[model samples]
Target: MIAHLADIESMEKSFRTNLINHLTGGKAVHLIGTYNEHHQSNLAIFSNVIHIGAYPAMIGVLFRPIGENSHTYKNIQANKQFTLNQIPLSMVQQAHQTSARYPFGTSEFEACEIEEETIPEFDGPFVKHSLIKMGLIWEEEHLIKSNQTVLLVGKIQYISIEDSILLPDGHIDLGLAQSLSAGGLDTYYQLNQLTQFPYAKVLADASHEPRRNS
Candidate 1:
């Protein structure tokens, strides 16, 4: 059940309850390897990411404050670039466990057993195991009136998708790729193929399927 909030105190209480409930199924998608500079390494699993555009290839990350100047926030502000590595179904445990505040300069890559790839010119690291790696550049930051909530906008500089997940006509096969999702606020879920829906537009393939033997 979702608890309603009347004020800050009630809101925090509701948030706490919501967070707990959301994590019950152990299937919720977590935003892994978020960074910072001044304070401790801020790592929080988030299910609030959304794709906003294709032309500019932007994404929206809604970061709720666990207090101010989190490493992830500060790092983006400093370097203006960050990487989004989509966790596979097998890495949920390590991803969920990253929601701790480690000491400043203590890389979660070490603590969480995640390997880092130092991008050519950026000041941050990318996860070594993600199937989809997106190198993004900061586009805008919008502040919300309530507390420290921030809406970050970023544009994709480069994108890499594993070959198995790429389908013909530029579509992704989530079921074959075993793509995951978050639920009701917190639980994580994996996807499987039910059926293929017809496409709206695509260039027809010249190859044809082999005929069945009579």
Candidate 2:
């Protein structure tokens, strides 16, 4: 089970890729929707989305190498707008199929037979089956010189979620939405809430150290 750097490099390419990807644990699964100047829509699945800041409501997603013909990246570059739709447990199959490469100008929404929906003012289409969705405006792109991966930052301009899952304190219960998660490139999982903890604060008399379950 112990894999060193040298061991990883010597492993089979596909096996090494899956091992490294799974080493990061579970990641948010989303369908990034975009459109070119001609209004042709593209949908692709991504797992590297992460929160950047709350004040500006920014998020970042890692796109593969710049040399790759990424429809989602190109569309975002062209229009500076995109939508992030949470993949629901019910639509995991269709959502995963979006990663397949189709001909240029082909709509994955149509190719995968998934329903596409859009808000009145939104620029890109959103997955109709998703329980939570976000419309974002591209802010900037940062290139990782080591790996050639592009990190795209975006500001959240709009959000839509089912009212039943909204909490009084502004948090959405993702478990209620049946949001899907990924372990690596292919495995999908359903999320479940374990426990909720209150905000932590150190005590004046003694340090408030967290208790270990074991």
Candidate 3:
């Protein structure tokens, strides 16, 4: 199982990709919805979304090198607005289908038969099927010199969470929502909360740590 850079580079392309992607374990999966200047909608599944900050409420999505085929990237670039929609377990197949290489201007929402929804004042469409949705404005982007991938950051402008999953303390329970997560590129997993802990503070004796199955 030991693999160095040479060993990894020598592996088959698919194997290398899968190995590297899976090494990160489960990743949050969402359908990024965007719109072009023509007002055409585009929806694509992305697992590279990450929380950038809470103070400014920013998120980042890593996109492959911008190219003619990068419809989502182009749409976000053109409109500066996008939506991230969480995929529920029931819609895993439909969400994955959004990754297909449909021609430019062909809406994946329609091609995949997923309903599209819009909120007041937002330019991008949201997934009507998703229980958790967020509308964001493009804040900035950076190109990764090593890989040529683009890290596009967005500021959260609006968010909708299913009422039942919203906790009293503000945590969203993914298990209650039945949200689906991607293991790598193709594998899907269901989430279940294992435990919760209070804000960490170092103690003199270090004897007050919360214990589960103790």
Question: lDDT winner among the candidates?
Answer: 3
Give the Cα-based TM-score of candidate 3 against the true structure: 0.94
Window of ten residues with lowest summed lDDT in model 1: 24-33
After superposition, the stretches of candidate 1 with alpha carbons farther than 4 Å from their true spots are: 1-16, 19-44, 66-69, 121-123, 184-186, 196-214
> What lDDT tens digits, residue by residue, belong to model 1 across residues 71-141?
67677776677777776788777776666776667777778877666566544466777777777888997
lDDT by residue (tens digit), candidate 3, 98-168: 99999999999999999999878677899997989999999999999998999999999999998999999
Clash statistics: count for each candidate? 9, 0, 0
lDDT of 2 by residue, 1-214 (tens): 8988899889999998898899889998999999977998889999999999998999999999965568899999899999999988878899999999887799999999889997797878899988899999999989999999999999999999888989999998989989888989899988899999899877678956788799
Which scores better on TM-score, 1 or 3? 3
Backbone clash tally for model 3?
Answer: 0
Q: Local error of candidate 3 at 110, Å? A: 0.6
Question: Candidate 3 — worst ten consecutive residues by lDDT sum?
Answer: 201-210
Tell me the TM-score of model 1.
0.73
Please report how far candidate 2 places residue 139 from its true position, in Å: 0.3
Which residue runs of candidate 3 sit more than 4 Å off their true CA positions?
Answer: 207-214
